[model samples]
Target chain A: MAVKAVKRIDLSLAPLVENTRRVIKGLKLHTICDSGNCPNMHECYGSSTATFMIMGNVCTRDCRFCSVKNGKPQEPDKTEPGRVAEAVVKLNLKHVVITSVTRDDQDDKGVFNFVETIREIRKRSPGTVIEVLVPDFGGIEELIETLVRARPDIIGHNLETIARLYYLLKPDSSYFRSLSVLHMVKEFNPDICTKSGIMVGLGENEDDVIEVMRDIKEIKCDIFTIGQYLRPTGEQFEVKRHVDEDEFQRYEVVAGSMKYAYVIAGTFVRSSYRAGEYYQKYQESRKG
Target chain B: MKEIILPELGEDIKEATVSFWHHKEGDEVKAEEDIVEFYTDKANFSVKAQASGILKAISVKEGEKASVGQVIGEIEER
Candidate 1:
C-alpha cells in the first residue's frame, strides 16, 4: 500500500535571510539553526536572532533524532567565546542563546566552555540577555554548578522525548537525569529561569507528554515547549506520524492549565527557535 | 526595459540596505553575474544580474534601504 507523503510548510525566503546566513558564516560561528536544520531558521535569521552552537558541531553521543554529526570532535577552539561574543554584538540581539554539542569525551564534559562563552558575551555585549541550553552531566554537582555560576538568564535542558521511549530514541540519555538537572537549576538559583522541552510524534501518547510536563513543572521549570519530532536525517528514525495542529493545541491547553509561565506547543516550535520572543512575551505577561 | 526587484530574503526581514554596487550604470553586466551586494542584520548578499545588459538606471542608491518587491534598478536591452 502506498501512503501519501505529507508536506511540511516552510517559511518563504525573506530578504533578511541572506545577510544572516552570511554573517553567521563570516563570524565562523555555528548555529543550531544550521546544525539541526531547524524549521524556524528563516524566521529566526530574518528576525536577526540565532541560537549559537558553541564548542563545535560534532557530538560525542548519537542521539537518534539529532542531525548533529557524532564522532571524534576536535579540540575546543579557545577563541570560540570571543567570536560568539562578536556575533552577539554584530547581531545586536537583546537576548543571546548559546548551546553546544555533547562533549562527554572531555574531562569536564566541556562545561568550562559555557562558562567562558557567558563571560565573553557579557564582556562584549553588556546588555544582551544570555540563555544556555545544555546537556545532562549525569547530575554531576560540580559540572552543573559551573554552568549555574555563569548566571545565564535562562537555563534549558531538553528532555527531547518521553520516559517510555528514551531507551529506543535517546538511549544514551536518561529521562530522570534530565529532570534532576532542571531541578538543580532552580535549587541553585530560583531567580534564573529553568526550562525544558519535549518532542511529540515519536510514538508517544498524550499521557506521556503530560507526564513529562508534570515532572518538569514539579522541578519548578518555568518554560515548557512541545514540538513534533521531524526526523532530522534519512538515517534517523522516520517520522511515525504527523501530529496534527489540533493535538498540538490540546497539548498547549493542558500545559497552560499547569504552572508554567510559558507553554509553547507547535509543530515547528523548538527549544531555541524564537526563544527571545518567548522570553519577552513572558515578561510582558508578568507585568499584566 | 527590465526591472530588478529584490527577491524574497526571509520571513522576518522586510527591507535591506544596498551595501555596495559591484556594477554601476553603463557597466556591461552578464546574466547571472553578481552586480550588487545588500546588507541586513545577519549578513551580506550579492544579487546576481537577471539579464545580460548595459546597467541602465539605478533607483535605489547605495546606503539606502529597499523594501521587498521594490525595484532597485533597471537593465536596458543591449
Candidate 2:
C-alpha cells in the first residue's frame, strides 16, 4: 500500500444558534448530528441549519462504521410528520434536509414516513427547498417510486464505500443494489437531481474509487460527495489509510470530469454538509 | 465518577491521537464544555463534557492514540 502524505487543514467551527435549538426541542426529533456525533454539527447548527433524521434513530442494519444503534426498530411516529413541519416553519430555513435510519423491519422500510414527512414539510414550509437521503429499501421498486412521487428537490442514496469494501464495511448493503437505486431515481424523474456519496481510506485503491465513480455516472447521478471515513467506534473496522488533501482534490477533478453536475470532496464533507449552498448552485446551473 | 470515552468521529475512524486537553484533573468544567482535542483522519475534534463536573483523571496523555469507545478521562460530578 502506498502511504499518502496527510495534510491537516484548520476548519472554522460554527456555533450552535438559537433557531437550531428551537427546532430540536420543539419537534422532539433526533438528528444524525447529535446521535452520530457529526463534527460539522457546530458549523451546521450555528448556521441555523440541520439535517433532520426522521422515522427513528435506530437502524435495522448493523453497519460497522455507523454510530446509529441497531436492533429491532421502534414503530414510526405518526405525529413526526406534523412535528417536523412545525419545526421547519419555526426555523424559517431556506433549505431543508430530511434523512432516516434504515428501518428494514417494516414492510415498506419506512417509505410512508418519508412520503408524509415531505408532504408535511412542503405544506408547512412551501418556500423551503427539500432534500432527502434515503436507504435502498432492499431494492423495492415500489418504495423508490413512492419517494419519487413525493417530488423532493433532491433524492440521495449513499453508496457508502467502494465495491471491494462493500461486504467488509456494509455487509447488509449491496453495491449493485445501491447503484440501481440511483439509476431508478433519475429514471423516475430525470429532472430530480440524484446524488450519492462514498467514504475513502477503507483500503480501497484509486482504481476502486474510479470504478465506483464510473458506476455512479453510468446511473446519471447528478451530485457526488467523497469524504474520508473515520471509524465510528473502536469495536468497528480499523482505518486502512488516511487520504490526504491532495488526493481529495484529485478525486474531485476525476468526479467533475466524469460529468457529475456537482462534486464536493474533502475530509469533513458529509451528504448534507453545505447542502443548502449546493442545492442553490444546482438550481442556478439548471437555469442556464 | 464518570469516564469520558473517546467518541467516534465518523463512520470509519477507529483510533485518534490525543492532540491536547483543555483542562487538567481538578479543574471545574461546565456542562457541555469542551475538555479535550483529538485528531482523527477527518479533523481535530474537541470532546466535550456531558455533565458539569470536575476533571478527575486523565487516562490518556496528549499525543497518544486512543481507540473509539475507549475511556480517555474521568470526571467527578459537581
Candidate 3:
C-alpha cells in the first residue's frame, strides 16, 4: 500500500456549495457525491451541478471499489421522478445527470423510474440536456430499448476498470456484459451519445488501461473519461499507487489517437465531472 | 477598516439567505466571532467578523440572498 496525501482541494466554492447542499437536502435526494465520497463534490456542487443518484442509495451488488452501501434494496420511490425534475428546474441547470445503484433485485430492474425521470425532465425543462449513467440491466435487450426510447442526451454505463480486474474489483459484473451494453445502446439508436469511464491506480499498468479504451472504442463509444481511483474507505481495496500526472497525460494522448470523440482523462475527472461542457463541445464540433 | 465578506462555503455555491444576525450595527465584535448565519440551498453556515471591531454596517438582512464576493458587512477596527 502506498502512503497517500490530499492535494488539489479548491476553497473558492464555499458560497455556492451551500446552495447546492441546501437544495439536495431539502429535496431528500441522494447523489453519488455523497454516497461514493467523491473528492470533487465540493467543486461540482459549488458550481450548482451534481449527478443525481436515483432508485435508492442501497445497491444490490458488492463491488469492491465502490463506496455505495450494499444490501437488500428498498422499494423504488414512486414520486422520485417528479422530484428530480423539480430539482432541475430549481437549480436552473442546463445539463442534468442521473445515475443509480444497481437494483438487480427488482423486476424490470428499475427501468421504469429511469424512463419516467427522463420524461419528467423533458416535460418540465425541455431545454436542459439530460444524461443517464445506467446499470447493465442484466444485458436485457428490451430494457435497453425501453430506456433508449426515452431519448436522453447521453447514456453512460461505466466499465469501472480493466477487463482483468473485474472478478476482483466488480465481482458480480462481467467486462463483456458492460461492453455489450454500450454496443446495444448504439444498436438501439445510433444518435444517442454512448459514454463509459474507468478508474486507474489499482495495480493496473498503462497497457491495461489502453486495452479497456480499445474495447470501448470498438463498441463505438462517443465519450471516454478516465480518473484516478481513491480508496473511499479503510475497508475497501487499498491503493496500489496513484498514477502520476505524466502517466495521465500519456493516456490522454493514446486515447486521442484512438479517436474517441471526447476524451477527458485526469486525476480528478469523475465520469460526470464537467460533463455538460464536453457535451456542448461535441455538439458544436458535430455542427462544424 | 476591515471589510467582512462572505467566505467561500463550498464548491460552486452562488448565493445564500441571511438566516440570522448575532450582532448589530454599533455592537463590538471580536475577530472571527460569529456575526451572521446564512442559509444556502444545501446547508446553513455562520459567518465571522474579519477583525475585532464595531459592526459599522449591515448590508444584508435576514432572509435575503447574498451573492458570493458581496460585501455583507463592515467592521471598524477599535
Candidate 4:
C-alpha cells in the first residue's frame, strides 16, 4: 500500500461561508456538508454553495460507511420544501443539490419530499439548476417513476462500493438494486441526466473498481464520481488503504474513455462536489 | 499596463482563493494565456491574461482570497 496522503482542511470562516451557515441555521435546515462532516465544508460554504439534506438528518438505514445517524426519524416536515426553496433564493444560487437520508419507514419511501422540493424550487427559483442525490428507495418502480416525473436537471444515487463488498459496506442496500435505480431513471426520462458515485480505499481491488465502473456505465449513467473513502469518525468503517493520486487519475481517464458525459475521480471528489459545474459540462456535451 | 481582474465565476459564487501563479513577475505572457488559477469551493478556474505583456505584479499572493472583479495582478503591455 502507498503511504497515506496527508490532506488539509481549511478552517477559515469567510463572510459568505458564515452567511451560508447562518441561513441554514436560521431556516432550521440540515445540510449533508454538516451532517456528513464533509472535508470540503469550509470551501463550499465559503462560495455560498451547499447540498441541502431534506427530509431530516436521521437516516433509516445503517450503512457502515456512512456517518449519518441511523434510527427512528421524526415525521417529515411539510414546510421543508418551501424553506429549501427560500434558501436557494436567499443564497442566490444558480445551481442547487437536494439530498435526503433514506426514509424506509415512510409509506412512499421518502419520494414525496423529493417531488415537493423540486416543485418548490421550480416555483421559487426557476433558473437554478437542481440536482438530487438520492437513495435507492428500495428500487420501487413507482417511487422512482414519481421522482423521474418531477424532472430534476440531474438525479444521482451512489453505488457506494463494488458488488463484492456491498454486503460489507452497505449491508442494507443491494448492488443490483442501486444500478436498477439509475437504469429506471433513464428509462422513465432519458432526457434527465443520471449520475452515480462510489468510494475507493474500501478494500476493493482495481479490477473490482473497474467492474463497478463498467456496471454503472452499462446503465447509461451520464455522470460518475469517484472519491477516496475517509473515515468520518472512528465509529464508521475504517479506511482499508488510501488510494494513490495517480490511481485516481487512472480511474478518471478510464471512465472518461468510456464515453461518460462527465467523470470526476480524485481524493476529494464527492457526489455533489462540483455538481453544478458537471451539469454545465453535461449540457455542453449534449449541445456538441 | 493592464490589470488582471477576476471575472465572474458563476451565479452565487462571489469569491475564490488564489491557488497558483503560472508565471513569475517579469515573465512575458500572451493575451488570453492562462496566467493564474483560482479555486472556489466547488471548482477550479484558470484566469487568462487580458493582453500580451510582462507579468509586472501579483497583488494577491497564493492562498489569499479575492472577490469577483478584484484586480489580482497587473501586466506591463509590450
Candidate 5:
C-alpha cells in the first residue's frame, strides 16, 4: 500500500501566433496543431486559438497515444465545410474547436464530415462558439444523434484514459464505448455541453481515478479535462507517472465534487486547452 | 541556434514516419531528451530535445515524411 507521489508541473510555454499561422494557411484546414504533439500547442497557438482538424489528415483508428495519421483516407474534403467556414471567418474566432481523424474508412463514421463542419461553422462563424472534439461513432446512437443534430455549442468526447488504461491506452477505444458517448451526449441535448477528457499519467488508480469521476458524473458530463499523459510516441504510451501540481489540485477538488460544470485539471490541460477561457467561464456560470 | 522544430503529433497527423536518430550531427542533446523517432497515425514517436545543444543538422531522412512543423534537425548550442 504505497502509491502517492504525484508532483510535476512546469508549464509556462506560450508563443506562436501569426493569426495562428494565418488560420492554418487560410483554411486549407488541418489542425490538432501540426498533428497532436500538443503540449497545449504552444499555449493554444500562442493565444490566437486553434483546434480544427477536420475530416482528413488520415486516421482510421490507430490510437496508441495519437499523433494522427493512419493511412489511405483522403476523400472527404467536399470543400471541408466551406474551408472550415473560411477559416472561421479568417480567424476572428470567438471560440471554436472542431476535431477529427477517426474515419474508420468512412460509411458514416465521419458523421458526414462532422455535420458539414458544424454546418459551415455555423454559417460562416456568426457568433462563433462551436466545439466538437468527437469520435465514438462506433457507439453510434445514430452517430451520436447526428452530432446532436448539428447543434454544436460543445460536445467533446474523450475518455482518453482510465478504466484500467482503456485496454492499454485506447486499444481501438471503448471504456463502455466512451461512457456510451458521454451518455448519448446528455440524451441528445440537455443544453448540449457534454464534454469529456482524462489522461492522468497512464498507470491510473486512485480507484481508477474515482471510477473515472463516477463514470463522468453518471454520464451527465457537463465538462471536465484532466491532462498529463505526455508520451506522444515511443510506439506510444509510457508516461506511467507524472500527475503532479498537487495532483492537479486534487483533480480540481475531485472534479468539483462531482458536479462538473467545468473542471480543467492541470499539467497543461488540453482538449481545446484554454478553450476561450473555458467558454467564458461557462457563460458566466450559466449567467449566475 | 534554436531550430529543432517537428511537432504536431496528433489529430490526423499528416506526416511523420522518420523513426530513428537519437542524435548525430555532433550529438550533445538534453532538454527533454529522446531526439528522434517518428511514425504517426497514432503512435511510435520520440522528438523531445527542444533545446540542449549540438546535434546541428539532420534534415529529415530516416524514412522521410516529416511535414508537421517541419525542420527535422539543427540544434548547435553545446
Candidate 6:
C-alpha cells in the first residue's frame, strides 16, 4: 500500500484570503507567509492570520532552502511598528507572529525593530499575545537581552535543518550559534517560552533527526516542531524525500517522549503554524 | 438576462450566507464591480457583476444561505 501524503489545503477562492491580502497591501506590510511562499498562506490569510515580516523583504544572508529574497536591504521602516500594531487590531488577531529576514548588515542585526514592534503592540493592544520568530541576532547576548526585555509572549528561532547539513543549507549561519540563540532565551527569561523548529526530508536519516532533538533537549528549549521540507521552487534546494504520515507519527512519539512543553510533528506543521493554540495550551499548562 | 450564480469557492466549502448586497434591486451595476458579499464559516467573499446591468431580483436575501452555482440574483444586461 502507498503511504498517505500530507498536502497543502487549496484555499485560493476564499474571500477572506483576498481581503487579508488587500489589508496587508493597504498597510504596506510584508509577511513571511508571502515572502517565504509558505504553503499555509491562503488558509492563514483566509482566517485573517499572517506572520508579519519586519525590517524589509530583502535579506542579508542566502540560505539554500529559504525562498526569501537575499540582497542588500533598505533601511528599516520607522512607521512599521505602528503599522503592524494597526494590522493586528484590524485583523482582530488574538495572537500574532512576527518574523524578519536576516539583516546581518545592520549593527544590531534588526533587534531594535523587534523590540519596538513588541512595544507598539503592547501599547495598542494590551491583551493581544505576541510571538516573535527571530533571526539569531548573531548570537549576541545583549541584542538578545534587548528583545527579551521587550517581553514577547514567545520567542522562536528555527534550527532549519540538522547540524551536519546546517552548513550546506545555511552557509552563512552557524548551527552552534542557532542553538545558543534558543539557549540564551531561556537563560535570559525562562518565563517567556522559547521555541525552535527543524525541517526534515533534506536527506537526513532518522538518527540525525533524533540527535538534533537531543541537542535541543539538552539546551532545555520549551517547544519543538518538525515538518517535512517542501521544495519552494526549482531554484531552491530540492526535497530529498517525501516524508510520509507514518514517519511523522513516529517523530511525534519520539518528540513527545523527550519532555518538550509541546511538540508538533507532521508534514504540514511549521514552527508558527497554529501558534496561538499552542500558546494557549502552554498557558493552561502553567495554570495546572 | 444574466443570472447571478454563486461561484465554486474551492475545497470543502459547500455553502455560504449572503452577508450584504452592495447594490439594491433596480440599481445600475458596472461589469467587474462587486455586487454582493457572501460569508462562510471561514471567510467573507465578494461576488462581482458579470456585465454592466440593472440588478433585477435578489433570490437570496441578506443573512440567507446559498449553495455553489445557485442563482442568488438576476441582472438585466444593457
Candidate whose DockQ is highest:
2
For model 1 the local lDDT of residue A232 reads: 56
Candidate 4 vs 5: which has more DockQ? 5
| Separate DockQ for every predicted complex | 0.05, 0.11, 0.06, 0.04, 0.09, 0.04
TM-score of each: 0.77, 0.78, 0.78, 0.78, 0.31, 0.77
| Minimal lDDT window, size 10, model 5 chain A | A5-14
Model 1 lDDT tens row, A73-191:
99999999999998888888899889999888888898999999999999998899899999897679889988998899999999999898989988889988999999988988888
DockQ of 1: 0.05
- Please report, as a residue range, the 10-residue window in candidate 2 chain A with the lowest summed lDDT: A6-15
For candidate 1, list the clashing residue pairs, or say none.
A14-B9, A14-B10, A15-B9, A15-B10, A19-B42, A19-B43, A20-B42, A20-B43
Question: What is the lDDT, from 0 to 100, of the residue A216 in candidate 5?
Answer: 82
Q: Please give the TM-score that candidate 4 achieves against the real structure.
A: 0.78
lDDT of 5 by residue, A150-209 (tens): 888888888888776667667777889878887887887888887888877778766687
Off by over 4 Å in 4: A6-13, A286-288, B1-78
Q: Which model, 1 or 4, shows the larger DockQ?
A: 1
Instruction: Indicate whether candidate 2 or candidate 4 has the larger TM-score.
Output: 2
**Residues A1-288 of candidate 4: C-alpha lDDT, one tens digit per residue:** 664543333322345667898899899999988777676776688789999999888899999988789999999999999999999999999999999999999989999999999999999999999999999999999999999999998999999899888888888999999999999999999999898988998899888988888898789998888998877666888888878889998987887687853678888789998788877877787678
Rank candidates, lDDT, best first: 4, 6, 3, 1, 2, 5
Q: What is candidate 2's lDDT per residue for A54-97, written digit by digit as tens? A: 88878899888887888887899999998988878877878888
Q: What's the number of clashes in each of the models? A: 8, 4, 19, 0, 13, 0
Q: DockQ score for model 4, please?
A: 0.04
Residue A208 shift from truth in candidate 4, angstroms:
0.9
Give per-residue CA lDDT, model 6, range A13-126, as digits (tens): 457877887888899999877776665666688788989999988999999987788999999999999999999989989999999999999999999999999999999999
lDDT of 6: 0.83
Instruction: Report, in order, each candidate's fnat.
Output: 0.03, 0.13, 0.03, 0.00, 0.16, 0.00
* DockQ score for model 6: 0.04
What lDDT is reached at residue B68 by model 5?
71
